[model samples]
Target chain A: MNTYTNRQWIYSKRPENVVDERHYSLQTTSLSTTELKENQVVLKSKYFSLDPYMRIQQSALETWERPHPLDTVQGGAVVGQIQDIHPSCREFEVGDWVLSYTGWQEYAIADVSGLRKLNRDEVPLTTALGILGMPARVAYFGLQDVGQPKPGETVVVSGASGAVGQIVTQIAKIKGCHVIGIAGSDEKTKYLKETLQLDGVINYKKFTTQKEIHLELKRLAPQGVDIYYDNVGGYITDAVIDSINTYARIIICGQISQYSDGLDTPNLGPRFLHKMLYKRAKIQGVLARDYNNRMPELLEEMTPWVQQGLLHYKETIVNGFENLPKALNMLFYGKNTGKLIVEV
Target chain B: MNTYTNRQWIYSKRPENVVDERHYSLQTTSLSTTELKENQVVLKSKYFSLDPYMRIQQSALETWERPHPLDTVQGGAVVGQIQDIHPSCREFEVGDWVLSYTGWQEYAIADVSGLRKLNRDEVPLTTALGILGMPARVAYFGLQDVGQPKPGETVVVSGASGAVGQIVTQIAKIKGCHVIGIAGSDEKTKYLKETLQLDGVINYKKFTTQKEIHLELKRLAPQGVDIYYDNVGGYITDAVIDSINTYARIIICGQISQYSDGLDTPNLGPRFLHKMLYKRAKIQGVLARDYNNRMPELLEEMTPWVQQGLLHYKETIVNGFENLPKALNMLFYGKNTGKLIVEV
Candidate 1:
């Protein structure tokens, strides 16, 4: 029997504010190929996807699903290679690349049904964590289905340099929309403007108040925002809402700004829902999991865009499994430009 | 030439807080019917519709339209009788009851195209201002079209005794939804529970904090709020949002609580949009004007309901045209139930 050592990060504490290393405990275990059941395979996790939702799941209240079960593996998506497969598993072969929700671990035993084979030569393995994966699914559907972008309409996207927002910004441009990208750093704004070629970009850190941000957005989006793809909800959302045109569509993809302490005890902000009434606008919240069944449709369109270099993406890859919890914390600090991934 | 004395409440000033007599100047003018043009008719305003939207229009910022122009007659809907008609007008004769956007004036000359003939014998003429008018229009579409309520779904309506709320509550019940009403007073709660037969009622005044309201709502709606008809936006809305079930639809028809000062300078409230993300919910704003063309559809269904006594409504009619400004103020104070109308 062949044996392997698996290092796993166990979620040990619920966060009241920011999630950090203190919330997780690293544990080591041994896995043997002899224990593999029929139709099961052993996976060596190559990459782990770290997302803002990880923090949201750490929240005490129920979100999309029950708060990540305490004292278990920190559940997340992983891009891995099949290390061993049981004789009953005919679909997958050893050494084949695949995607699985094997979480923050060096090795995991997954049921073959739960794994999706990845074409190693089609795209980079890391893209499964971002551009060709969950983020792209939400961006395609959230903007196209809920936002219903039209030619010449203005679209403002917060967290523009992040995974979903970056895709949303590019897609809006592809749909003939005048896109304005909002990010936290000058570097991210530069990428949005020079590389993505967005119509406008705003670095929210330059503005201290929502009123200031509103004024800047007014100057940039003189035609008024027709669709706002919000990923960071806070003063930035308030300002964008203030700048929306009549019949605007606001797609709530993520509220990373509020996932910290605010999710447990909400942060107070100006009441602006009255603006919805005045503008006859609509705000819809979207989750990538809601569109999981439509992945084939998303990949069919996105795979070509990505291969053709029409869809641009950046990945801030952090090395080492021990750095997983620390890398997740980088998202809240706006330290990463795009998808934040950790390689084991 | 027939002469008449017109008492007009001219909107001379914009209010910073509650709109009252200080914002208007009462003027009396003599008008001759000889000046009436082709396709024009003279109307004697009888019942002035005092709605919460009036305060929204009075805001310093633009709402559905530009701020109500200063130094002009206060714009509003009125149920009136045609006193005279030009030879070119064949649609109606003198003494025919009609609904017109004639403002807060006792007499006015209107183009025939802007008037809809109302049947006095079919229902009380006042019904044209409340149950069968703008309030009912928004209530019908805002609840049925935007809300898309399903049977057995739980609906929570804020401002349950107000113009739009009363109609929304009854329609939600008619649609087989379990309705919970949040109102300002025991009288309104009693009306919602006893008269309207709502499943639950919450006197928001009884609870000082949003958490308390959320707890009470949880106790009342153990199944969770599937639809929230928001006529009042503030802590009440914050609480309802907190207790929403997945895929809940929130309809924003009116924000009476925020109209006074919040419209100009938005009031501070807890930012609960993250809940929207967790629940995958949606919030949509509906304006009566957007569904003006569908009035016939609304009247076709609601007229019989009002006449057959299946759909119940109330009107706090303040006598005399001189009280128009005061009646508009009553809405902000929550002093009137259902529709507040000035009966001249």
Candidate 2:
């Protein structure tokens, strides 16, 4: 077999505050003999997911359990085709498209347990990294399990144009909730209203102060929000939380606003207890990984919706393996409209 | 029958800040000879309940539902003897003791539906205002329904010496959880540990700073707290929330800490989203009245425990109807060891 080179992004240093390419090192390694261990299979990645969560792993932040150390391949979910497999491995065949947490590399030696084969004929393979995959599952579980939006209830979603937020908005809408999407730019808010047909869109950029945000939220959710799918937790979340009705559900899916600073930044919002006590609200946090075992149930409900054009998704794909850092930074700046991915 | 005079503390003015006697006025009204309204009963209050919730009604603050207007009789829960009833009323007897939301008055004319008859032989009549009544019901529902403490889990009770908090602590222990009580005084803490048999007690007054409280919490709850029954919300809550374990349940029962100032004071605690996201914790607010229909189930379980000496309660009773304001102020200052009540 002809030798192929594996291009990889390695974590070199921790980002002080905002992450950039300076935090990672790109290196190339050539395959030798194409040998694999007993349970390992060599897979060639088609799409590398550039998620906001990747920044947490790269920074050695305490945001997640089992923090990744420096000088290791940047770990992330990737859609890949199996090029070779060990004779002992029974899970895959050559050219089989599979989803795996194979990191930022072209080819990875993965175990059978680390990969799940996907059918490209049924749905586009790249969706395993976006709409039909982990992000979708996050939105589904978070919106349903935590947010629990009832019919006719107003559901507010922050970071409404991002991968998870978009799905969260659509799912809440599908659940018969009056969904309000809060985004940074007019472009995002406009797209959410015009394309997704959301109930309302509040461009947070137009509202500079907390009072402004509060007023905008009051206008959008007149009776106060019943469900809040919080993606960007800070002023936006505080504003949404301020307008929550009694028995409101605030689901914490991501705190991208604080993730940049490793959440060390001080929050000057009112203490949660008083408001919670008065409203009898429930604020719950959800991580997609925690609900991995329940994916089949999520996909069972979501797949038909996607197949029937009831659910929509967008991808901001940066070509080439080297653009991983840039693609991820797009998430931090709110530049991406939907799923931010790197196509290798 | 001889005419009787009804003396009442009317809500003369809205308290600007900390509630005092200035907000209330003593007024007397002679019983009219008018025929009794259907289903109405004349109640002579034996024990007037001066509760923290009463302060909320006394203030024009935006906490709790259905604000009270000035010059109305100050509304509160009370244990009273039936003085007279309408000829149409068949549910109650003239000498029967009942629990009623009769406000701060020696006598109140109430509808039959507004009162629940009490059994003084099984438990003390005054307990209908306290441990065997509203406070106990709050603790039972808040702890079991919201907190849901698991066996061997660390359960922290804030305002641990207060009526609801004391009951919550004991119930958590009965559920086989390690109970930690956070109180304002060393005397309260000692009572929690010695009398209530709590696993640990933190006198919050001894810890002036959040850091001090956090360190002490870390040492006591080495594995982190699994459930938090938060009655007093502020620095103590912030510290406890900081050390919450993954999937921890935080039940917000009351915010007595902020009630004194009508929750106007800004809290400098860390924002909850990031930590809650990482831990996947659930923080819920509970109002006992929301679970009012479930009180029969709570009392069924509690009556046996109280009768068996497995459950204990304390009350700081201020004598005479005149000490209502002072008795309530004692709740604000954390002067009461357990339930704070007034004998009329």
Candidate 3:
């Protein structure tokens, strides 16, 4: 075996205010010369994905303020190549490209269960994390199964330029829903409408209030929205709920507003459930990882849409593992336009 | 020509506040012998069942508050005997017993489209409204389908002494779940435990806080409540949500607290969505009228249970059509246990 070194980022300490250079410290460790276990493979990570969910894990100790924790190497997805595989690890060959939950690392030991052989080489490897992997899968099933958008019905997606929201908008469009998107910037609003073909885009920064929401939504979708894919569950959700058509469905895929800033803080937006009951609406909470059998079903459905040029995905990739925090910070601040990933 | 008289309560005007005798006025209306139209029948009401949903219909001007129209006599279930039938109405023969939405009246002109001919006479006529009709059917479907209780689960039913709650508590018990009921009084609590066989009971008026809730639930269930059948959607719902186990389901069949109360009044307690999301729970809002096809199925399933001494119903009957407003008031005030009805 060739001599090698594996540099990894381990969980240093739980984050308090914000994740910076200190919250996660870079530690370089030597590769073990010990015999490889069966069904294990040594892989070289080519790219790593940074996401807001990690910030949730970083602040796990914040008492319902943050999400749960992972005790091992900070978990994330990586596009990697199989360097070597033990005899028991079948179906993978040396040099085969694979995606694994290897986190922010240069090279890592991957368990077979966490690895998937990448297909469709022309599509950028980074798309695996955004439009093809977890976030995209979330948007795919969340809108279809949970939101249950009907053709020609009005559909609204918050965080439109983010990995999940972008795909959700495009998917709704393909299904013949009148799609409206909400983002925080002019460029994202333009991208959502011009590039992704959304019917309307609302910059939440430019306007707020139930009245403004009513007027804008009426102009864009006069019939009223039937399905709301809620990525940022705060006042925006409240506004959207206020404008919902009867028996509307809401997919609570994430509460980016609360999850990013932390939950226990006084900055969190007020709760919204009365609106849910008033409209006789449904709100479903979900994660991409929870879509086990659904993941491949969605991937199969989306592959054709992407191939037919109906679906598009954009990635904002940062170079080097040291920028992992920066790439993830983009997610928290809503700075990154699509899926945020890091190349090592 | 035969003459008929109906001593009925009419909705005098749109309800400006919680409905009382002021919103209604008792008047005697004489009916001239008018010929029954096609698909119509003439019926004399034996019992008019008063329900919590009457409150929802009384406040229709509130935008979301869907109130029944003024002077429509306000619709609800009535057990009646068909006095005459038109040539086209073959489903019900003259002198056959039937259940219909005949409103607050001694006599009703029923559209055959909206009436159910009673098949099983083994049970009392009042059960047609209280347990075997809309309320009981709502309880059965809401708990079985929406609440989705499993064996060994714990179910918490708010308004546990009311028409729907009594049936839900018993059904949960039949499904092998430990049931905790929230009623307003000790006598009703006794009815819940001794008659309805609920595992535990709480007078939500007395105990407060998650601490008291946790203590009672811990002692009774220890395993945590797995399903919440919420009828009174206010403080009691808050307590039930606090005691729910992960992945628990809440059936939002009625918000008795919100009906006819002014929009801005203090009807809300704790917002339920956060706990719903964190617990991966499901909350379903239901109306029994939407489940008409299932009525025959429900009657078939529940009749045996009622006849074999497994299922039972409680009726709080107010004598005479003059007492319709008072019976309705009793529902709003929580003064009547189980279904409140007026014998017309």
Candidate 4:
């Protein structure tokens, strides 16, 4: 029997704010070939997907039984190659590439349920972390299903140049809905209209006045918006809620604005409750994990779009595992455009 | 044709607050014995379901709609006999009893889509306005589905002695849940535990401190409340929002605390949002109309429980159509238990 060792990112202590270098301490541990469990696969990290959801898992969802003495690596996205596999794990062969939620580490051991066999030939394995896996599926399901975007209806997506928001805006356009993209910068805003082909784009940072923000949104959504994909909460959420048309639907995929502060109690303004009644709207928080059943269909739907150059992706790649914290910080500050990737 | 003209409760102007006689002016007119439109039914009023919903309707859902003239009637509950029916209206007969959304009126005309023909012996006709109709179905469905109560799970229903709250508490008990009812008065609180058979009851008016409120709820719900049905908003809502268990579900049926002032925006202190994420709880606002397809099934589930004397109801009846305004005011003020009915 061969012995194998792996570096695992474990949640050490709960984070109290934006996850900084101080919140995580990376350590390399060894495993003997004899210690490998049945159905375990040793994965060599390839593509790492940085997401806002990782913030919650490190701070709020660290309920594991492992007794840790504070700082350690926190968990989330990694696309990797299977270096070794226990025979009991029949899902993959030793050389197969896979996307696993292995966090910020060079290598990790995963049970069969956590790894999905990757077909990089259809779409590159790296795309699996961004436009093809969680963000794409979140875009596919959140807009098409939860937001219930209808043709000719107006749809607005905030954080438009980011991984999830970029796909959401494009999908809305494909469905014949008038898409409006709201981002923080002029360059990303320009790219949204010219590159992504969204019907309208707004650089939200310019509108310091509520009246201007309201008027700009109203101009973009003349008939009023039928769907709002709220990735950014606080004022963006407030503006979107106020602008919704009758029977509008909002899919709350993430609250990037609030996440930085570590999900504090949000001041939900009054008009929101009133709108929920008058517009007969629905707002639901959804995690992509819940849509695991639809992954095959999602890859199928998004395949042609990516291949034909209909769907484009941009990656801000941090070359070493050591810079994983910096990559994560980029996402928290809204500095990265498209997907933030760590290549080890 | 013998003419005994019909009258309607119409919204003359936009109401800025809880509707008073000043906000309304009843108009009477005679209808010609002319041919009816397809899918139409002419009805004579028996009981109108005066609800907090009418307050929104009276404002024409405005803060959200076009600057159109006030609607023909200030909406309320109504049960009436079919006075006439369009030849294409397949569901009704001249003598059939039907419950409808016909406003404060002695008589009204409705389309088949808005009318539900009633079976007299199955439950009292008034049940359409109270226990066996919209309010009852809301309590039943919201609790059974969203609340997902289990035996020993603590469920709190605020505005506990109102029309919907009374039914929610009873249904929770039927499903083997420990029920806690919150009302405004001691008399209503006594009725909640003794007559309504709730496991525990609290009068929020008596609990002066938010800490006391939390402590009392913590005592009754030692395991932490699994569900909260919020009918009344304001401090009571804030207190219950704090006491919920992880993964709790809140069915937002009404916020009577905001109905009277129209301008009363309950400031949910900023931390409530964090509670939602940390608790992984769900808060959903449900309109009974959206649950229309389940009405027959709702009656079937509730009737047997109601017939076995397992369900009890109380009504604060005010006689005459003139007192309709007063009856509805009681509903907003949280001054009545069970359903408030008007003997027109």
What's chain A's TM-score in each predicted model? 0.99, 0.96, 0.92, 0.91
Where model 3 places Cα greater than 4 Å from the true spot, the runs are A1-7, A12-22, A33-35, A55-72, A83-90, A260-280, B35-41, B60-66, B82-96, B119-121, B242-247, B260-278
Candidate 1 runs further than 4 Å off:
none
Ranking of predictions according to TM-score: 1, 2, 3, 4
Model 3 chain B weakest lDDT span, ten residues long: B262-271
lDDT by residue (B153-193, candidate 3, tens digit) is 88988889899998999999999988899888999998888
**Residue A227, candidate 1: how far off, in angstroms?**
0.6
Per-residue alpha-carbon lDDT of model 3 for A1-344, expressed as tens digits? 65458777776766666666666667787665254688888888888887766665555432223454443567788899888788887788888888898777787777877788887465667767888888987888878888887889999998889989999999899889999999999989999989998889899888866458657877888788799887776667767866787678878776777654444342433333444445566766666666766777877777777777778877887888778766676777888898888887
Docking quality tier of model 3? acceptable
Considering summed lDDT, which 10 consecutive residues are worst modelled in model 4 chain A? A60-69
| TM-scores for candidates 1 onward, in order | 0.99, 0.96, 0.89, 0.81
In the range A123-242, model 4's lDDT, one tens digit per residue, is: 787888888888888788878877777799999998889999999998888899999999999989988988888889889999885457668999888788888887777777677776
Whole-model Cα lDDT of every candidate shown, in order: 0.93, 0.84, 0.76, 0.76
| Chain B vs. true chain B: TM-score per candidate | 0.99, 0.96, 0.93, 0.91
The candidate that wins on TM-score is: 1
Q: Candidate 1 lDDT, tens digit per residue, B1-344?
A: 78999889999998999999999999999879998999999999988999888888888887888899999999999888999899999889999999999898989999999999988789999998889999899999999998999999999999999988999999999999999999999999999999999999999999999889999999999899999999999989999998899999999998888988898888999998888888999999999999999999999999999989999888888998888888888988899989998998
Which window of 10 residues has the lowest lDDT sum in candidate 4 chain B? B262-271
> Scoring model 3 with DockQ, what do you get?
0.25
Model 3 CA lDDT for position A238:
65
Clash pairs, model 3 backbone: B60-B67
